[model samples]
Target: MNLLFKKKDTTMKTIFLLLLILIALNIQLTNAQPTSKYHAKLVALDNVYEGDVDLNLYGQNPSLVKMEWTEISPDSTKKTIHRVQYDMEAVLSFIIDKDTFYVKNLVDDEEKVRPYYLVRKVYGNDIVALYQYTSKEGVKRIYIGLPRRDPYYVQHPFFTDGTNMYTAFVYFKDCDALYQKMKAEQDGYWFKKGATDEQCVSIWKRIIDEYMNCKK
Candidate 1:
């Protein structure tokens, strides 16, 4: 009788342990599911798509964009989840939360094209744009894109020392004059020691507006 009771107790403990393990696995799987959605515009498609969008990278370069969304039929009777992948070149832009991102072609010193998402667009138009990119390693870079010119990296004036100061103002072929003008004004106090990030962004917007006016 004593042996039988001991065996029963042991079995009960084993069952409880197994149940706990199953519960832990279920929780982990639930947490692993993707939940965030984005608004995306593709170069090939005219209509905008609202979905869960991911930038799939291949060896540190963006190879494609994966999108998943549910479509409801016209009759409102059926809903199907659709999953699609687009080549990196096919994606024009996407908005996650409230921030907009554009596809930027990053060219190396050897002139090879490496595509990455421009994380932020400080200023942009048909003719020229200023964009910021954050790499996988969390390094941030600023870029200026212009017609007939390769998208080139520029030293961020607010974040770095004023070395290569003119690079930040190279929005046009004749921007040398504008750079000199801003330089005289201390480049909107960007070179000031211990300037806050918010202050720097405000100064950049003002300078970009001034530069854009010169192009008009």
Candidate 2:
């Protein structure tokens, strides 16, 4: 009986040690996580459009895409103008096969990022689609921010192949978490559907300006 009692005591001690460790880890995560200054994140889309396709025929998404910056700033100022510049390119192909598309979504093959962000262009609150797609199949398979019910795998996915191909690079933080943020904050932006190259550069200029002015 004494032996059994000692064994039980040992097990209890081990369990207690584990619980303490878990609590410490949880506390670390809470403290270490990055915080944005603004309670209200400004959700915006800056478009760099590729070629358009007819839905009557199925194919991959186009090559040579564009990117825009959306911010959730701490300050509340309407119509603040800032400039950003995106001047990086890489050697890789963004292609689609029939209904499926493969989007690296990076400037080049060599660059690396942690894929810390997600962009969901919504027709409305209920409607969300990723950047690439097949017109006939619609956005049924290829979307980043779809609300999945039981199978949580459907939400905030990267490098997922389906009706559309979604891609991500290295981000400063976790990819899925960043994606969840963009999906949740659903705010409208100055979306330029098919702006000219010059217009697009101008938009980047605004981003650079804002990014510099904003506190890191």
Candidate 3:
């Protein structure tokens, strides 16, 4: 009886060791995967909310954006992440040069001409789009109109410019499926249950880094 009990104990210990090794290998494999090539960061003007009006269009707020640009994939298959921090206000405004792009407020059918809450900024050769994140009424909500393409425009839009502004269209349209997938992966370790806004942003940056770095 004593010998049988000892053998059972040894078998359990061996099984536990193997499980640990397997877990380690899985983690290693996950971290060693591949990512995409097109990535850019707007590093200079993070907290400069009150800078020159031309420079900071989405006043008194900060946001981070990430995008996956792929031609072979469908537009819906691409991903964009926008994380923002700002005061709780009903509407936000912005301005763009006439040559850049035209944004119409579909709510009013009026062209966005004044310094009201618009999401994208286009200057010399670059475009920046902002998305204000909210979780009170729902999960990850922001609003903006699509850019009106200019035939004479020279610079192509960065993925951040084109995709980040369309948060509802790009993300929340299928948010339920995404949320479920994010929750199931790594037992929701990246942005765990009941995560704070800052924590969620951090997780987004981590995900972007992994995607950009070609990691699984």
Candidate 4:
């Protein structure tokens, strides 16, 4: 009888331990999955939509796919969900996870024109800095948008070859004193050999901030 009781106790303990292990594994699996749905607000040429949306922005055929939810009953108990594919050309902007993206026609070095989403980094009185992730290059490309001039790519201080550096400074020429100051401080600003992307972006933002302050 003593031996039987010991076996039963051990079996119960083993079952409890197994249950804990199963629960831990389930939690790990749930946390490992990427987010598939998000609440988003999109602005179009004539309409605005706000609801749960699924983004497929990195695939071969990138798109802004939105899932809209509507109340179907007076009590707001019944809801209907529908899928919509937004016309990329007609979309002006969108907000997701508190980040705003603007639709812009981006032209590449090869003169290829395509619509891409740009997130504003710095908006000053005279110029605005915008950036977008280039999945093919696995890096972010920054651009300067000026009045009456098409937005052009600017070299990432640490990532690129600095081919556009001259053009970028030229655009800043309107702010003559600030441009000269930035030109003189160019080496100190972005010449770090091994700075990270975030560091480079910070430096660029500081430069723009200085420009804005000087203009005022």
Return the TM-score for candidate 4, rounded to 2 decimals.
Answer: 0.51
TM-score ranking, best first? 4, 1, 3, 2
lDDT of 3 by residue, 127-177 (tens): 112233223354432222223421111111211233322332233223444
Q: Which portions of model 3 show Cα errors greater than 4 Å?
A: 1-184, 187-190
Candidate 1 per-residue C-alpha lDDT over 1-216 given as tens digits, one digit per residue, 9 for 90 to 100: 999999999999999999999999997676442333345544434556677765422122345567788899999999999987877666666766566777677654345655554546767675666677775577766565656554555433323456544454454436666676755656573444455545555665666676678777
- What does the lDDT read for residue 73 in candidate 3? 37
TM-score of each: 0.50, 0.21, 0.22, 0.51
Residue by residue across 71-98, what tens digits does model 2's lDDT show?
4456755443333322212212222232
Worst 10 residues of 3 by lDDT: 150-159
Candidate 2 local Cα displacement, residue 83, angstroms: 36
The per-model lDDT (C-alpha) reads 0.60, 0.31, 0.33, 0.60
TM-score of model 2 vs. true structure: 0.21
Displacement of the residue 186 alpha carbon in candidate 1, Å? 14
